[model samples]
Target: MASNNTASALEKEQIFGLAEKEMEYRVELFNKLTHTCFNKCIEKKYKESELNMSENSCIDRCVSKYWQVTNLVGQLLGTNRPPV
Candidate 1:
């Protein structure tokens, strides 16, 4: 019983570690995406504090393309599982 408990504890620890790693990776990806898309889509720096129509449309396309590529790569790699 003690050995079983130890094994379960180890498994839980491993799962938690993996979850943490995934969260970290997702955060990194989000940051990169934000930087890349903002640079690519926002051509003009406006002082109005809100995105213009063109900027909003560009950002929409940028995010859509990003996810499309990510999903395509995931499918090609046979790891087509949806993110948690």
Candidate 2:
């Protein structure tokens, strides 16, 4: 039926809209995290243009801890269920 089709189309559109928004939010969060962690963990500048071992370790830990906290906050907020 035309009415059913319309309803279905609207539902799909809403789902896609939410997905788009979520993707945008994730990208923004990743950018923020990258900038914040990089600034916090990498203080030295070198001509080699490569992260030293300590810097690499600090960055890894920083990103991991950031996501851990993010996930915890998300859980507390009861926003979108945590991934399986």
Candidate 3:
């Protein structure tokens, strides 16, 4: 029916809007985490230091682990669920 189609279309739009908002929020969080983690994992005084292999490796692993933690926490908070 035309009314059913209209309702479905509206629902899809609402879902899409929510998804967009969630994506924006995730991008913001990622940017913040990258900035904070970079400060914590790297030394300002060693800016001129060529990529110390060990430091680079540590930073890479820390970022990966932090991302995993963020995802787990986000899942626990039901971030993927629709708002009431």
My TM-score estimates for the predictions, one after another, are: 0.85, 0.83, 0.64
> Residue-wise lDDT of candidate 1 within 1-84, one digit each (tens)?
999999999999999999998898788778877987999988665667888898899999998888788777778778854232
Ranking of all predicted structures according to TM-score, beginning with the best and ending with the worst:
1, 2, 3
Tens digit per residue, CA lDDT, model 3, 28-82: 8778777866886777777664867766887898788777877777688888632
Positional deviation of residue 52's Cα in model 2 after best superposition, in angstroms:
0.6
lDDT of 3 at 58: 72
**Which of candidates 1 and 3 is the stronger one according to TM-score?**
1
Q: What stretches of model 3 exceed 4 Å from their correct place?
A: 71-84
Top candidate (lDDT): 2
Clashing pairs in 2: none
How many steric clashes does model 3 contain?
A: 0
lDDT of each: 0.82, 0.84, 0.77
Please tell me which predicted candidate would have the highest TM-score against the true structure: 1
- Pitting candidate 1 against candidate 3, the one with the higher lDDT is 1
What C-alpha RMSD separates each model from the true structure? 2.7, 3.2, 4.2
